[model samples]
Target chain A: MIKGSLTLDPKIIRQDFPIFQQAVAKPLVYLDSAATSQRPSKVIDAEMEYYQKYNSNVHRGVYRISVEATEAYERAREKVARFINARSPKEIIFVRSTTEAINLISQTWGRTNIQTGDNVLLTEMEHHSNIVPWMMLCKEKGASLRYLEVDDDGFLSLDQLDSSLDNRSKLLAFTHASNVLGTINPAKEMIRRAHDKGALVVLDSAQTTPHMTTDVRDLDCDFMAFSGHKMLGPTGIGILYAREEILDRMEPFLYGGDMIKEVHKDSARWNDLPWKFEAGTPNIAGAIGLGAAIDYINGLGIDQIRAHERAITSRALDMVQSIPGITVYGPKDPDKRAGLISFNIKGVHAHDTASILDTHNVCIRAGHHCAQPLMEKLGVPATTRASFYVYNNNEDIDMLIHGIEAVKGVFKL
Target chain B: MSEDLYKEIILDYYKNPRNYGTLENPDMKAMDTNPLCGDELEMQIKLGESDKIADIRFNGKGCAISMASASILTEMVQGKKIEDARQFNKEELLGAMGTPNLGPVRIKCALLPLKVLKLAIYSHLGKVLEGDDRNL
Candidate 1:
């Protein structure tokens, strides 16, 4: 079901990242990788290499430098395409972020395909990015938006999903891995079920691509969106991966210079598959940095990263639960989660817990995490989340435990 | 906020919030919520002779800064003239709490109670709450 079952030493991985060197306090234990990861020196150097060597506009100029720049840019796209196991590079379209990628599909394919009686399916645990766009599209098209319920243990019911999907269920969009609940939804099974009902699946892989391998062919999702920033690449670049057949049919999301074939005053012919959706000057440096990030992950082995996180998370779950008055959300099994934990200490608000942790120089996120409906379901205003990555180890877990102890001390609980 | 100040002042007021309750059919009352972090606050006050603040209480579930600030604000204004309590400001409130540095977002947590109390007073007097909330 997953890859890279080997273990790795995070200490060596820490040496490649420069931010770990400069600590504001004694130890800067970062437990917020789910928000955005700390970039490695290699990823940073790759962006600098692009600017220093071949900084020219892509596909427009005929000079040598222009040719090199275009190759670097398109090569990055090809790297992303291969990384996700897409059939062709043309299936991968570069966008601003996962939010923009979802909007592109909603604007083009959803606008045309979903009719007045059509229904779009979503889950209770979707991030605002997944929910809001479809809501806007469904409202505009006179189509209804429905949801599959999340159970008390934080898993979506497949039995309910089976009953809900029908001929009118035109599209089903859901998160591949929940950022807050830490639930890794069974994407392959969900896609298979949706396909059986003649409903297309849009997999939001923003939280999964970093922690696990994403094989588009294996899952058979019609569309997928994920960000580079969360996966240790630079911001301003993200991937919108749709199947070749669907991407070939959708119109351009943005229209500009690079996306056009031949233009007249009256009309213009659109460019090829990926370029048709990508408008204007692309994030050349950002794409190059993303390619470098992929290379680095490949070097370290994503499966090793996954196995290491599971080891750390297994230890963390037991450690966190040992403390009295602790309530951990999501599945109890480590295999069911990604690399994060969202929890709360009894009688203490998450805000107070986080600030107290800050005093101990242990960084964690404390808020609704943009999943307000999930918060309402959990009966919590917010949660204190500790997300691990390839750089995190047992020592950082100690810091997290120490910070949580400080919260207990300050509250005298 | 300073760790020392946080341990001493804020935690005390938060754990044992003074004047933390609701008054039945209160003379003046207002409630507000900070949508950013879901910090909620409700302040109820009863006036006496010359519209002096005779009784005051607050009720909410929030972070240390917000809860502590509400506790201190209630104690500081319980017997004062409504006019004087209405003139109370963030600087005075912070000063009374020993002036811990609540960073950008936490500062709003501290001001939530102050805003709700001001609105309660302002609404009873047929006046709108004044001053920028962040500044306050």
Candidate 2:
């Protein structure tokens, strides 16, 4: 691992991303990093190097280059495990995406452990990825699905979780941070409480992994999942961190060639922890890119990135609140959030607001953010979301504010 | 990316919508949602004995394009037949908006009202217009 304390002066970070160097449609104000992050040259070049110099199928080849390729692939897995502070590289299962990773855990663990009378505890602020799988699992198993509600500021009510964490609770899954509200849940505490009730906990870190330093070992959750695309890596690659013992107890998600020790006409023996979860040819380039992304994030440091986002979010909260008729959602304190901000303007539709912002070359997400239950709690069908990343700066926030002002002017509301 | 598409008239309708409230004893009612943006529109139609639309009312939340499109569409289809009203789709709305290159997002916004209108037609008349989904 590279040794360095984090320091983020936005000017220096912007140099790493080539997308910021060009002229933009409006002014290239990108605030949708929570959905997906912009890749740095280092991550891009890493993928290119793999295809250009060391292109081979890993684990099955005996040639010199194949060995090198296999080493790199395993090293990537190790890096992923290190990034999340998992106990072992074997615990890190590479899947197509966070959605797929959650589906894997749900199909394997949910199908096996959770019974008809069991309960799976989820949160209202969970993205559709985390909620839908458990819902499907509960429906199929004749189990009950429970949700932890949030306060008006989108704060997860841990006190409310006290009554819900009962003997029937077999699985507890939730997001580390909300994609829309940016509310960072008390993941460690939640994990502890769920464990107290003898339930497995899965943390969806798709929003948290990019902006915060994560140590799954310290969190001590049963499983955690995050997408590569949301952390400056290529799409179609994600990591599923399952505790080794838990994985050993769980069944394989898919059945195919690479995932089997030996196959008979009627039955097959599953290979191992990580491979059993990954059953296909896999996104080879994407894994390499994700490894490079871990390198990039580690180089910059997640603490520095988090600090930078805090500064920017503070500025954004001030700016958006300063505007009359503007209403901000989520917690008021920056420390309570990750790197996203959602808001609404009186008498303005979120799509209209987003369209006007797009005219100014500002990119923000405007919709339910796949958290329909949270949207209902917020009392709006949709809201404009401005998510930040390492590449974002004060100027980007200013541009977002300017874009909102322009929208207000055009609408004159 | 087209600010011109969100004309003053559109915002006027959004701020002080024409048919803001519900209708009493409505003849036809339809609700449509732009799943992408989460905009929901519930439109109610009042038809005359002559098989022509006498009045139209809508209640929902959406962007300027959808709100404006709904405002303009209700006006356009007030005295027209269900078939003729179905003909007024995104192309006519874009022509009304006077934009050359409208993106899919804006197109979605513009087509929200039309979708509700179509749903109303389908529910009332039992026939979905051809190629309505592809209009955007």
Candidate 3:
């Protein structure tokens, strides 16, 4: 037996999430955290407290509640900055989702910097959010988009990266951890290489920041985008962290409202670092909820969470590989991968497998997983993805294995 | 037993699909893809005399529901007239699947072949009305 490294007691952790208390078709084996994590009561209570106590807009209102609301919102920003280890809170710009964060970068930074014949390097394992924005930006700017190929084992080829990172490459946009494959790319080393090649790196940490400890300063990435919902927080809130200099240089993405210093009839000067990017009213409650989520994760300790997930993932991978005709994707070493596994049983469709698992109260994400390009590259239509989190334990993996066996039984394989 | 969405018939159709290939010099051919799942179906119908579907075939890749539905669709519309084939609705397709209570996502997979068939018929009608005989 592999030595267990889980420090957090999942039984106790599940108590913090009240969703388990409610009735369902069967016992919920939530293995879909990579899609969206279930929110804990702390995060839910934080948002509820915001609405119950001070539910006013931020920045403009000088009333007492407004001031308190603004303070809470900015405090959330500070919490996020500290969570990601950014130099200052001004580097953290709140957006709707990871998709919006990437879009903001593409529109502001990409529009300004990318030129005709410039290349934006993306990896094959990227979610549609990371790939689509760059594709649109490159098309609009007449710049070319290149991909860093993923090998058969679901790891990106460094040789392909080296060859692709020519002087014409302006930005290296890649996922820190793949949502489907669970392969954690070496962001620090890749960032260093891209910086040497005179290219800015945009780290799509939507799948990474929630699971592992992330330090933007240490990674030295020019920009990083991640969603709140994927990290046990509410949806409609995401963070985009850019260096101060880069934020100062790029134009504002959305126009109008609080993003401006003064709105003249003709042209107007923009607001300071973060506010200029955050136009209109933001997801106030979502941000505050994310702050509570950060605290929850911090209290549990991200290192311990990573270890716990690694243990679950390692066990799942081992047991899954033992099954006949099962093909598991991503790195074999548990340390190299995030807390998830993507696999397929031979002669069984991923949807069928997922349906059967769902009947067994095991929730695994199936379909192309918004990474059609990667699916095509993998030579499969789709694969079933089961992602783990702090609340998931060895029992969940055992349930999933049993669910897979049930699927085989149902299919008469 | 309660969760038998993958019935033996569905699996049989998926494993041994009927009329599962391309057609040469077809009268109508159209394709539609489920962008969410990357499921695609390309349908071809060779119209015989009196606008009857003399031969119908489908070629694509998708989940069991989609592929089986496509296979079943080819068998359903093979001898039907163009007008009758075009009139085939989602309920009839779902009925053929033997599972009317498909979940939201699977519904899309089950109806993809019907959508493609309707589009093929529409294209054929459009071409005939436009006085264009060349294959589309």
Candidate 4:
């Protein structure tokens, strides 16, 4: 745990988010942070400040406002680099979302590197963003895609890792933390094993980066991707961190505008490291907002945030376990998981359960959660998930429990 | 009590769905799945004389709204002419549920059975129009 000076108080923290103040028919118990987090006032204000003060295109313009805009944008890149403890800002490539980032890697890097008969190893718990791109890549390259099976407890089978890896394994792409199960995989160990087999690793950190301290250098992953919206920032902006050497060798995923140094008819020279990957007019205000979100998280401290979420998840597991006919998925130990719980009421469908909860304004996700394969493995059509963040507290969990009881009552279970 | 969407009737139907099974040598069978919620329903109908639905059954899994709607739909359309069953729409389904409104995300669940019923009837019509009278 990376400790910081700041302490978290959910009451005070909730004030930073304006959504909490909006009056509704019922009090809001938002437990859908795993889907997308609610943004704070500071993050919102940062974007407004950029547009209201100096809203100009970055990189190419020579005007004073453009320079300021460019400086703010570059500063946001630096903040993201520092947030993830990347060795250099050059490693940070901003894209639309984690989906686009993974697609970029699969198209540019995987296309050039992976050959026919090569293996792309993924886990059973991957989100569609992580799974679909690889499937496309493997199909195009005539390479086979393999999956490391997840057990009934939602933990990936590390025992099978040795056999799953071979010289033919070109890449190993897996999620750092599952969005549905909340099981935190041992990414560092997996990366080490993949490195021994000469396979590049892509860590899908969409769920991990927001809730925990992420140091790319410490994890030693070659490439990683996460969405800004999942971390209290604006939509339409995400980060893809790659090693400097690997990025230099990979081709650009998109063409035109700022990504090129010079364009002459049929041929063009690409721009420098990070900008080589970022094409056209970038999400300037979104990046600045993400920087402000990073500052906000830093103020609260990642260690404190993790501790607070762990406390909430521990209480939630304890309370939810006591509910009759309610079976929670993922690891039973709170420490082995992130701050989410996907579960099912024995006799009630997940959608019906979600609908009943909505009557009380308790927001949760109910579906296959974009992991349909995993849903089949779990033998459930869908599961209702309640994920927590820094702003959540015990009262929210209590409200959730009450809402669930109401579901049982309404269904006469 | 306060405008509850899942009323007693809906829950009752969900718990004990009517005409829930697979039909043997059914005249027409069709399946549809709600991609968003992973709700799936398969409808089978046996056409009797005068193109009436002699027997109907549905088998699959879904939410209370979808399951209850399927049960109610199977019961409503049984013994009805195929053309009349084809005219069933969202208003009638919602009215049967005793709720005038379904939130946007859930409306698909409420209407999946209707979609399956329409597809099954259309398929049966196509088969009949094509003059494939072996089973008819």
Candidate 5:
């Protein structure tokens, strides 16, 4: 248990985030990092500094602050490329969020490659962001969508993935770590099998990249997406990492002021890679905050964070399941999962559980978690989820348990 | 808001919901889901010889507040005139539930039955349900 404890103390980490000091309830127990993370003071201050000191449009300004803004924005792209071990900064495209990043690919890459009768492969556990774009693309292109089944314990079978890929399979998009199940998929092996079938892979790293080390080159995925807001950065900024060869060949997703090199009344040439996809003025402050967030994560060390979350998740899983009639979802072994846990009480609805917990100022997420198809596969309408991050610790889990007991008392379970 | 919710009466209605079943050959029936929370409700009313709601039933899956609201709504309209059932508002239904100070989100859960009840009546009467921005 001592080894399982966080090497970087959560109490100490909580002090870095201003949100912890001020909440409707004292000592905020934020267990919803899977949905969105609270930013640290460094990230917040970085964004504020961008707005206050160097508030200028990127790339267009010949003046001092504009150059500074452009430098900061491009430097952020370089940091992201290094963070994911991408081949070049040119391969990293900044967009709104993971949702918009996926849509960008669906528009630029998917619209061109996917043909009628070509099917896209997805897993049963993908969030709606990954699923809906493909569905829309398939519907528009007269293609179909197939899913790899998740087992009772929330693990996807590589054998099923191998069998599911065939001549019609154009692309396989899946989450590296599931938001609901917290299952850390065998991403490298999955990508290899899909490549063996001559299929492109889009890895949704929205959940994984925030919690642990993720190398796009090592995974050998064709594309990857993650949001800044889920990793101690501000919202409205995300990264899309695509293979340089493919990205260089694909047309731009968005066309506007910043995405083109020269424009005429009817004719124009697009800008270089990375900038070609970024249309209009970008979220400069958000990207700068993301750079600061990367610095903060680097300071803490990703491996240490992963280990700490693993230890705490194991403890949380154990403590959560100890309650009578509690059915915890995802891999029981913390190694097979990430930092979150989804579960349900036998008779208590997920919303009721969340409400009772809310009374104690213990926040949790209920409802389908924007994974209704996954919810259907789990055979439950909704499941209460208590996710964790660097700031959360044992006391938060205790509060969660206290809230669960309250739920049992109120509902007479 | 949480302390005000899940009162004994609310829990009682949730545990043993009144008229909690499907009606056979109903004169009016409508079903809708709260897209926010995925709470679903179906309301059905049978017309009696007096052109009133002889029987009303609703059943679905959701949180305690949603289920309890359905239970309370069914009881409220079981023998009311069709016009009276259509006139049933959120205030009346929430009042029946002892007027728990629900927040904006949970208030939707509490009023979903009333919305579906109104829809069932309006659809039967060939009139569009409208006017309340609160969507009662």
Candidate 6:
């Protein structure tokens, strides 16, 4: 069933990415999209066009080129808002990356709302970016930090959440998808539960926003953050989506030009919602490139992309599990996963597995995946991970399985 | 995949590993892991007079390249000076391996034992070996 959705002629998708054209020592079977996606021609061209034709500082200048740049930058924000079904461009604020976006929210909203003796709820699956900032805020505010435990398979246990939620829970920040485990959490339900407990929910959509359709309204999350680089756009730009009411409550994270309206020697009045959060000259080129990424994604359709990834993941899971010595991590059901899988083979360290795969010209991620807590929970120091994207196909999965088998054969395991 | 990448000599060492366990009377010890891939190594060295490596042993978990590399590394450095062993760089090691295409990951596996060796040797002898070029 998934095969039909993710099914495409690999030759066509291959055309869009120039890197695939290179005749490397081995086949470049890229399976690390969970880290950052490979860019298509459209995104590359969009950035090039901006630099070549309309290179100028935006928002401040009244000149034609600057006007064009400013318009392009704002238009990209509109595209981002639309991509996630956000209500308005005002809801979208660009930061350097998802880490920066999360930091902005935690420092601003967290400092203002969370009081001493209050609690901030997080999950064990959160990346350092999502977990550490909250930890910093909680430490400063004398607020306690609580955790929602994950199951043996690495899924967050709602039962743990049920027991943990309380009056003191002011903020519930968790990931929409586990970066290490690739487990897709039910954000809408999680949001509802948090709201019932009178706690605002923040979704770390860094992993999910790239692979699936993220309807912020449907999820009812107070804030959502994702990076542009992870979605085939350029690096150094990210998006933070907050509900208008929530945006009104937060303080500005950074204070500088463009974020302030009226400045006095002693006091300064901040600008409107989004601009207040985005201080200094923003990533205009990155924003335009992100817009092109949005267009590329839209052209393919996110649902279609999700379906394609599911297909690749299903095949990958089946193949990896079928191998006698392999120990698959995360949920067994492919439907519960997003676009990636993690596993280990008995007697094979993940790094070694990756090295053997590299000899085959297959690129995979091997490590804690920046989720040390999750790695501990999974009872492994590290695992080999193969994450997928829209351009990935069953052949890639086949290549991965073959690579693993070759590694096994080489080891005579 | 070329059979030369995982030569029989390397595989033989991995399967029938020498110095596979930690030293009983270790004069120096170090344990380190490649954070990127979770490959770990615990190396123990017994130093003779002049801080020569009287014997070396290792015990840990990793892939074929790492295990084989550890197996090869112990054999190469067991009777050498701690300082001389520290000077063994990637090129020298790769030259010893007879090829440079152990792949980066495997090379790291091969180097884990060496890194631990260097750290322990530096602390024990108060001398740094400058030959392990990490840039490769």
Predicted model with the maximum lDDT: 4
Considering only chain B, report the TM-score of model 1: 0.91
Question: What's the lDDT for residue A211 in model 2?
Answer: 83
What's the number of clashes in each of the models? 1, 0, 0, 0, 0, 1
For candidate 6, the chain B TM-score comes to 0.83
Tell me the TM-score of model 5: 0.98
Residue-level lDDT of model 2, residues A57-153, one tens digit each, is 8778899878888788888899998888887899999998999999999998888888989899999999999999999999999999998988887
- Top-down lDDT ranking: 4, 5, 3, 1, 2, 6
Residue pairs with colliding backbones in model 3 are none
Better model by DockQ: candidate 1 vs candidate 6:
1
The total number of steric clashes, by the backbone 3 Å criterion, in model 3 comes to: 0
Candidate 4 chain A worst ten-residue window by lDDT: A1-10
Chain B TM-score list for all models: 0.91, 0.86, 0.89, 0.89, 0.94, 0.83
lDDT tens digits by residue: candidate 4, A293-396: 99999999999899888888988999998999999999999898999999999999998888888878899999999999899999999999999999888888
Interface DockQ of each model: 0.56, 0.81, 0.49, 0.49, 0.71, 0.45
**lDDT by residue for model 1 (A1-413), tens:** 12233287777888999998885557788999998999999999999988898788988999998899899888999999888999999999999899999999999999989999899999989998999999999999999999888898889999999999988999999999999989999999999999999999999999999888999999999999999999999998999999989988888888888899999999999998878887899998999899999999899887877888888888888899899999999988999999899999998889888888887778899988888888888888889999999999888888898888878887789
Candidate 2: C-alpha lDDT: 0.85
Put down candidate 3 lDDT per residue, A1-413, tens digits, no spaces: 43355778888999999987778867799999999999999999999999999999999998999999999999999999999999999999999999999999998899999999999999999899999999999899999999988987778877778888999999999999988888899889999999989999999999889988999989999999999999999999999999999999899999989899998789899999899998899899999999999999999999999988988898899999999989998889999999999999998888888888888889999889999899889998889999999999888898999999998887778
- Scored against the true structure, residue A234 in model 4 reaches a CA lDDT of 99
Which candidate wins on DockQ?
2
Identify the CAPRI category of the predicted complex in candidate 6: acceptable
| Candidate 6 local lDDT, A46-158, one digit each (tens) | 99999999999988899999999999999999999999999999999999998988898888888888899999999989998988999999999999999898888868877
Q: For every candidate, what share of the true interface contacts is present? A: 0.45, 0.89, 0.58, 0.63, 0.55, 0.63
Evaluate candidate 2 and give its CAPRI docking class based on DockQ: high
Model 4 off-target regions past 4 Å?
A1-7, B1-3, B127-136
- Model 2 clash pairs? none
Q: For every candidate structure, what is the RMSD over all alpha carbons to the true structure, in angstroms?
A: 3.0, 3.0, 3.2, 4.0, 1.3, 3.0
Candidate scoring better on lDDT of 4 and 5:
4
Error (Å) of candidate 5 at residue A64 is 0.4
